[model samples]
Target chain A: TQLLEQSPQFLSIQEGENLTVYCNSSSVFSSLQWYRQEPGEGPVLLVTVVTGGEVKKLKRLTFQFGDARKDSSLHITAAQTGDTGLYLCAQTFYGGSQGNLIFGKGTKLSVKP
Target chain B: EAGVAQSPRYKIIEKRQSVAFWCNPISGHATLYWYQQILGQGPKLLIQFQNNGVVDDSQLPKDRFSAERLKGVDSTLKIQPAKLEDSAVYLCASRQWTSGGPGGNEQFFGPGTRLTVL
Candidate 1:
């Protein structure tokens, strides 16, 4: 019964602005994955954080996993119009052999040019 | 390499009608997955197959929904007497089994089939 709660369900920001979206859970996870899904397309993986307090950057985007493994965050330093999409966080709990993912509701972002 | 492929990019049906969608996984991939993504929500795993064998389908609504992976390659999912809440984008994904387990592998996704139940 692990659940992922994401904050700021919808965000509208101007181009070049910065923002951070959060994913929190009450249960500890073995790993966390970030994905970006555009309209009419399936989600594409952005990054995976396996270590506590680990941070990974993909260009202008930065992803961090909480030290307790109960939370994660995605920060965009300077978002562009192309970065507008729904951001999702998925968790892989320990002892899950099939690697099934339980995803958060997601944060929809719109970047105005 | 080619990615996963799904057919009928869009389908519109009235409630109580039947519909089916097809998916072809990436060549040599041993794992395939089907997911349902409601609007404003993340994708939910509907079923998972490991080389044509069902691995997990706990969340699938078996009463009116069915899926099959044939020959460990192509797959199909169907809904009979669909409900209005069934409207969502169905996505197909595939992954090659590796030593680190399925969780460590990356999944390649298809464009998804948008189902609209009116």
Candidate 2:
């Protein structure tokens, strides 16, 4: 199984605090994606980093993929209440032909306003 | 320009009862996926379809669960004689398509159907 392990299952911080979440796995992946999901809604894509040692930014959020393509990280600078939600990382596994994504148990973040 | 859509935003049923959920992917999307999400857990893929054809169902519980994407647009997922463990949110997502065979394709998800079994 291509399992992705996420760190800091739950985080609570005051407004304007910076935070970083990590996702790691033993197996290599072809691509990695980060998603943010709110209550009662489905996940929305934040970014996808396909290359090793790649970085993508979405406004105040920054995402990075490991050099081995086996890990990724999400960082939020000056996180506001609007930035609170579940952060998920999914990786596309490469096998024979088509690939499938395996998601990790998300990091639940709560930013106190 | 619409996102994925799902019906029965919430359903409460007793154990052993049967229920079905419907999903309509974004118009013109060829790939559709069904996923199950339990509390405090990430969504797990139950089945995947590409234009009315089954692409992957390795994680689906075949004995009591089934799904289909007929005509390559809307789809249905059914659970017969459901177990309490089956309670969760069922999410539908559509894969993005482009000229490069969907590289960097990000899935668009629906609000999801929340099923509660008593």
Candidate 3:
């Protein structure tokens, strides 16, 4: 079974602080996706990084896939309180056809105003 | 376009009781998925359906849990004789089947049904 390891399981920071979370795995993936989830709601897709060394930005959020496809990272710039939520990284293995995602434990972010 | 829909946003039942949750996938989406998410954890895939046929159900606890996607449009998940450990949020997601893609399909998620077994 493939497992994703997420770093800094929990984070608390004041508004305007910048932070980064990471997801790593020994197995290579065909693609990686990032999601943000708030309390009482299901996770929403943020972005999907398919190519190695790819970077996509959604306003204040920046996501990157590693060159080797074994790791990914999410960076938030000047975060606001609205950014407070759970961040998760999911991977589609090299040969998975059903599109079933293997997810990391996730990083819980708390931004204080 | 409407996103995925789920019924009974919250359900509280006693241990050993049975409970069910419903989900309506987005129109034109051929694939559907059910996931169980414990607090402070990522969602775990319980089952996947391609139309009315099940594609994968490897992670589901078959002894107590059962799910069906009838007509390939709507689905229901049931747990009989629920246990305290069964308490968690059940999320339903759907995605359109594209011929090919570099990344894979993007899934649209529903609000999820929170289940608590006392």
Candidate 4:
């Protein structure tokens, strides 16, 4: 079984504080995706990282994929209340017959103003 | 374009009761997915349909949980004799299948139906 372990299951921080969440796996993955889900809603895709040691940024959010393809991280700079949500990391199967996604338990973040 | 739509935003029932949820995928999306999310956990895939055909349903509890996507547009999931563990949010998602297959495409999600089994 391919398992994705996420650290700091819950986080609460004041506005303007920065935080970083991690997703680690024992198995290597071809592609990994980050998603954020708010209360009463399903998760929404934030980004997908496929290359080793790759870094991508979206506004104040930054995503990094480990060189070994066994870990990924999400960093939020100057967090705001709007940034509060459950952050999930998922391994996406590419070019496979099923091509399904396996997700981590997720990290719940709360940014208080 | 409209996103995936799910009905019955919330439902509460006693254990052993039966319930059904509906979903309408976005237009032109060939793949539809059903997921169950427990509290403090990420969503887990229950079933996958590719244009009205079942692509995968390995994790589904076939004895009590059943789902169908008729006409390749709308879908329904039914659970019989629900247990307390069945309490969770049911989410519907849709994705457009491209030549590259399921890779790289974003799966749009619905607001989800919260089910409570008392």
Give the alpha carbon lDDT tens digit for every residue of A1-113 in model 1.
68999988999999999999999999887788999999988889999888889999999999999999899999998889999999999986335336678889999999999
Docking class of 2: medium
User: How well does candidate 2 match the true structure in TM-score terms?
Assistant: 0.95
lDDT at position A43, candidate 3: 86
Q: What DockQ number belongs to candidate 2?
A: 0.56
lDDT of each: 0.90, 0.89, 0.90, 0.91
- Tens digits of per-residue lDDT, candidate 2, A34-110, equal 89999999999888788899998999999999999889999999999999899999876544324456789999999
Docking class of 1: medium
Q: What ordering of candidates by lDDT runs from best to worst?
A: 4, 3, 1, 2
Per-model TM-score versus the true fold: 0.96, 0.95, 0.96, 0.97
Clashing pairs in 1: none
- Which lDDT tens digits does candidate 1 get at residues B21-74? 999999999989899999888889999898989988888999999999979999
Model 3: per-residue lDDT, tens digit, B69-109? 98989999999989999999999999897335557778889
Error of 1 at A44 (Å): 0.2
List residue ranges in candidate 1 displaced over 4 A. A93-97, B98-103
Candidate 1 lDDT: 0.90
- In the predicted model 3, the residue pairs found to clash are none
2 or 4, greater by lDDT: 4
Order of all candidates by DockQ, from best down to worst?
A: 3, 4, 1, 2
Q: What is the DockQ of candidate 1?
A: 0.58
1 or 4: which has the higher DockQ? 4
Residue A52, candidate 1: alpha-carbon lDDT: 89
- Which candidate tops lDDT? 4
